[model samples]
Target: MTSDLKNRLAQEAQDIGFDACRICRPWDVPLVPDRLEAFVAKKRHGQMGWMAERMNWRGNPAALWPDARSVIMLGESYTPEHDPMEVLKHPGRGGISVYAQNKDYHDLVKKRLKRLARWLIADSGGEVKVFVDTAPVPEKPLGEAAGLGWQGKHTNLVSREMGNWFFLGSVFTTIELPVDTAEVDHCGSCRSCLDACPTDAFPAPYQLDARRCISYLTIEHKGPIDEELRALMGNRIYGCDDCLAACPWNKFAVEARELRYAARDELKAPKLAELATLDDTAFRAFFSGSPIKRIGRDRFVRNVLYAIGNSDRAELRIVAQGLVDDADETVRDAARWAAGRLTE
Candidate 1:
């Protein structure tokens, strides 16, 4: 009966739009606690202090909810249709991460997870809890334990079938379902992801120092960025995809099934000058459903100013000049730096 229920659950997940689904025990990720402690001890998480706050719950899924006997890990692909790196060549424009170019995945993925969880409860009469990226849950490690994918050298889950461009969601249930075998590392000798990092965020294979990660810098960071890292940021205004895009396994990546995951034309390669002009109200409306909106106007513009500084385009100097005396000190600092770089 448990085996039959698990089979139906996987089929239900696929019908509901998940690209892949697998089951694992909540306590399967035994290495997470020590690895997480080491990462926090070294101060690698940067401004993401929430990562350190949860302690036991973040590292151990069983502790998070003692009733959860099984973790149903799901992967939803958001693979970009075009080369995500193409926007970098147009320095006058800003490069937003492929995932942020459309609707926010948290809302989309959570809704799907809820539906799947509801189906599981209806089928087998067990309580369930769902999580996207928002919680302290180690979704990637759980995904790896569930055979969704192995955590690649980039420290992100990579599936031989779906590649690295997928989002992870989990449904924790009280039902004792059959678990799949953990996926083994298939990366072999490939260092493409490590070498492609613009900020050298990886300290070693299967390790990431979020302090130097462009994604953390542009989104999670609030204050003025380090001058050296700012220059290396290039035109990337939101999140960086260098490592994800550099993976050779992307050759096998499947197309995103959801139409909402497709890039919006306006966000594809927005002009830095136009983006720099956005006030708080306009910024909110412009990025209404985008994950970029969570950073707020000041940080977003700060990232834009940094991109403008890296562009080496004299025409955008005035754009930065306009924001030099802005209300936010960080934005003002970014503007001054960008304006000075353009003058140089």
Candidate 2:
């Protein structure tokens, strides 16, 4: 596709409600190998072995598809109407990650990216493949290379205009499209994200120790959480947002245009006592089509137990005690931990 055709595609994408779009040439992602090595060397990736699996392929976007010429990177905002931080104040309530508040973004983003790729094919007479987080591509770096955003110190892509609440999707095409010059960092002299972490997850500027990260603990960490970090987790039952919320660039973020990202009534601040009782069936039914479903009842209950343990409310003891003999060992461990916290 010519430069004019790619630019038109970007404009058309915006008209279709895509917040940001950029075209990046497939090339060696130089920084990713060191970053992955740093993460693995420190055991920061934790139990997510996939991060350590592929080497050459993880550092080169072209490795995923040698014939591909450009990566069309897209961003969709998922900002909430109300302050997502506000839910953390209510210790009795569970804080679901803002991204997973309503609907699954994977299906939503992939559908739109595919539509754009189809348009690109019709205009350019070429083939394309769509990817939404499922592929091994280094999306944040590609976004930076494509002028969509800079990868912030938090290691997530940040656009001066979109903040960190956006989801990334890409379409790799054989067409040699014009590239958008990369974006530069504007995080100048700001350390709000590093300072705000409850568990001090950021070990250094631009690097995160995922082991200490609450999001990793809640979602990625398979076993019971480290006891020291449990109380610091506050009401966050799924993922933490201290780092993302602290970025000043977030002022440009408008509320999510799609209703799927708008907070649901029951999800905003669900009762810990009520959630603690969810069986495997109830868990599936309640979190159907939601990202939380991927974790299953065992891990979700484990997190609830952590929250219950942090709660000073003696009434939740009954709920925690009931799970002391849960079928999942992780849940049972968390229950014992909760029971100990109340008794203490």
Candidate 3:
């Protein structure tokens, strides 16, 4: 009967647009606390101080919900139909990562997780709680424990069916559900992901140095971006996915079925020249439902300016030059750097 609940929940989750689902018993992710501690101790998280603030809860998932008997983890895929590398060819345009190109996933994942949790309570006669990325849950490790995927050398979860384009969510329940076998590593000896990085952010397999990661610099780092890493950022205005894109497992990946993840036309590949002109009002309107809004116009323009700096189009100098007198120092410095690159 317990096995039946797990299988039915998995099927229903797929029906509700989740790419995959698996259950695991309430247990500490024994290796994660040590790995996270080591990573933070080495100062790998960069300027994202929040990762340090929730140290205990993040390292130990069981402590977040002590009463929970099981965790039902789900994966929602956002794999694109085309090669992400194609965006690199258009230097004038900015590449936003596939996951961030549409509706903010937290809203979508939470809605689905709640539906699944609701059904579990109705069918199994028990209480349940749901979480997307918000909670201090070690989501990646929990996904691995639930048999959804295994954490690759890059330290992000990858799977046989969905590649690394999926979002993870969990439902914590008081009822004991049968746990699925953990997914095994399929990475073998391939190092395509490590070799593909423009900034060579990975110090070694299974380890990342955020100091060199473009994703961390643009999104996580608040102050000035490192000069060495800034130039290599190219026109990637948001998160970096060079590691995920180079994975061999992605060859078998499928496009997302959930409309929530469908790439937004405006976000798919925004032109840097056009983006530089967005005033605060325009920026707010442009990214109303997108995750990009969190960074605000100043930070968003800061990223856009970096992309403009790498752009070779002489015509774009006019746009970058206009921001030199901007109120924010972050934006002003970025504009100066961008305009200088063009003149030089």
Instruction: Give model 3's clash tally.
Output: 0
TM-score between model 1 and native = 0.99
lDDT of 1 by residue, 63-157 (tens): 99999999999999999998999999999999999999999999999999999988887878989999998779999999999999999999999
List runs of model 3 lying over 4 Å from the truth.
Answer: none
Question: What tens digits encode model 3's per-residue C-alpha lDDT throughout 28-68?
Answer: 37887888888899999888676788888788877777888
Worst ten in a row by lDDT for model 2: 28-37
Runs off by more than 4 Å, candidate 2: none
Candidate maximizing lDDT: 1
The runs of at least 3 residues in candidate 1 whose Cα sits more than 4 Å from the true structure, single-residue gaps closed, are none
Per-residue lDDT, model 2, residue 149, is 86
Clash pairs, model 3 backbone: none
- What are the C-alpha RMSDs, in order, of all predicted structures? 0.6, 1.2, 1.2
lDDT of 1 at 156: 93
lDDT computed for candidate 2: 0.87
C-alpha positional error of residue 199 in candidate 1 after TM-score superposition, expressed in Å? 0.8
